[model samples]
Target: MLQINNINKAFGTTRVLQNISLELPKGETLAVLGRSGCGKTTLLKIIAGLLPADAGEILQNDQRQNELPPQRRNAVYLYQEALLFPHLNVWENIAFGLRLRKTPENELKNRVEALLVHLGLQAEARRMPQALSGGQKQRVAFGRAIIIEPQVLLLDEPFGALDPETRSQMQDFYQKTAEQLQLSAVFVTHDLKEALRMGTRWAYLDQGQLQTYPTREAFVRDPKTGIEQEIEFWKNV
Candidate 1:
């Protein structure tokens, strides 16, 4: 379980996150929806240990991670871009983390091969980053992160750069992978439909304050989530 207790952050005089608190149980994805500049990324950064929180505690599995560095925190942050190593091929890129940990050669080979199949990258294993399409590159990036099995995955609009068709495909792929691995993640996105599709639980952020819902129904019922507006817009069309 990941527990964020009264997390607060500021940039100079501007408060970016104010008393943000939420709980993310293991094996579930908490989809956070917000517009740009709403501090969604700031909260994720604090949880990933990439930024200091002026006040609050970050606990993973009941252990405090406030003072831990990003590498030691057992949390992985994925950005909007795939950010795969340009020099490495798909298989090598996916195996990068395991190599760093000195995983047994046989085990690493088996694992990487399985992940390539899982990611539908088997035929592209030898292809370099530039050779793969955007969706394929993102799949390789996800494989690299999943190989290490981080305690929590912090996604910062990971599919935002993809075309609509590829984005939908990636979302479907992620839902399957999450269930298969029983992954725990905090998925951040501005798209309401995407959030509704991706999250088991939901939250909204505005002006640094967070609003959480106990169920999707409640989240959709709330006017601030814009679900009602979306429904109305579609109905009139």
Candidate 2:
């Protein structure tokens, strides 16, 4: 479980996050929805140890991690753009983390090869990131992050750049892969439908405050979520 205890952060004189608290269960994905600059990314960065919170505590399974660096946090952040290394092939990128940890060559190869098949990239193992399409590149990015066996996976609009059709496919793939891997994740997005489709639990952040919805119905019914507005807009189309 990832326990965020009344975390707060600010930039200069502006408050970015205000006393945020949430409990992310193990093997569950949290979908955080908010407008741009609403502090969703800041919260994720703090949990990943890329930023420091001005108050409260970050815990992984209840263990304090306030001072841990990004590398030591065991939480991988996946950006919207497929930030694969320009110099590495698909196979190399997936194996990069394992190599850094000094895993045996044979074990590393097996792990990367397995993930390649799982992500339907077996045929492109030797291909560079430039050779893959947007969806494929993002899948490779996902594989790279997962191969390291992170305790928490942070996704900041990871599929936002894909075309609508590809976005739908990626959401389906994300749901499937997450369950198959039993990975814990925090997904940040501005799209309500995407959040509803991809997460088991939902949260909303606006103007530095946050509220969580453990069930989809609650999120849809909440007055501040704007989900009903989006739904009504689509229903008349």
Candidate 3:
């Protein structure tokens, strides 16, 4: 389980996160929906150890992580960009993290090969980053992150750059992969449908505060979520 306890943050006089708190149980995704500049990314950054919270405790499976660095926190953060190494091919890119730990050569080969097949990248294993499409590059990124099986995955609009069709496909791929791996993640997106599809638990963020919902019904009913407005827009058309 991942728990955020009374998290707070500020930039000089401007408060970005105000007493943000929530829990993500194992094998679940907490989708946070918010418009641009609503502190969603700030919350994820704090949880991933990329930024310090003015005050809060980050707990992973009951262990406190206030002072741990990003690498040691066992949480992996992926940006909208795939951010793969330009020098590495698909195969090497997926194997990078395991290599960092100096995983045995044979085990690394076995793992990377399996993930290649799992990600349908076996045919493109030797291809360089530039040769892959946007969706394919993101797939490689996901494979790289998941290969190490981190305790938590932090995604910052991971599919935001993709075209509509590719975005839908990636969303399906993510949902399947998350279930297969029993992934525990915090996915933040501004797209309402994406939020509804990706999250097992839901929350809304605005102006530095967060509101978590107990059920999908509650989330849809909340006026601030804009679900009602979305429905009305479609119905009148």
> Estimated TM-score per prediction?
0.99, 0.98, 0.99
Rank list by lDDT: 3, 1, 2
**lDDT, candidate 1, 1-237, per-residue tens:** 999999999999999999999999989999999999999999999999999999999999899999999989979899999999998999999999999999999999999999998998999999889998999989999999999999999999999999999999999999999999999999999999999999999999999999999999999999999999999999999
lDDT of 3: 0.97
lDDT by residue for model 3 (1-237), tens: 999999999999999999899999989999999999999899999999999999989999999998999999989999999999999999999999999999999999999999999999999999999999999999999999999999999999999999999999999999999999999999999999999999999999999999999999999999999999999999999
Off by over 4 Å in 3: none
lDDT of each: 0.95, 0.94, 0.97
Q: Highest lDDT, which number?
A: 3
Ranking by TM-score: 3, 1, 2
Candidate 2 has which clashing residue pairs, if any? Answer: none
The residue-by-residue lDDT of candidate 2 on 181-225, one tens digit each, is: 899999999998898888899999999999998689999999798
The count of backbone overlaps in candidate 3 is: 0
Q: What is the lDDT of residue 154 in candidate 1?
A: 96
Tell me model 2's lDDT, rounded to 2 decimals: 0.94
Q: Which candidate, 1 or 2, has the higher lDDT? A: 1
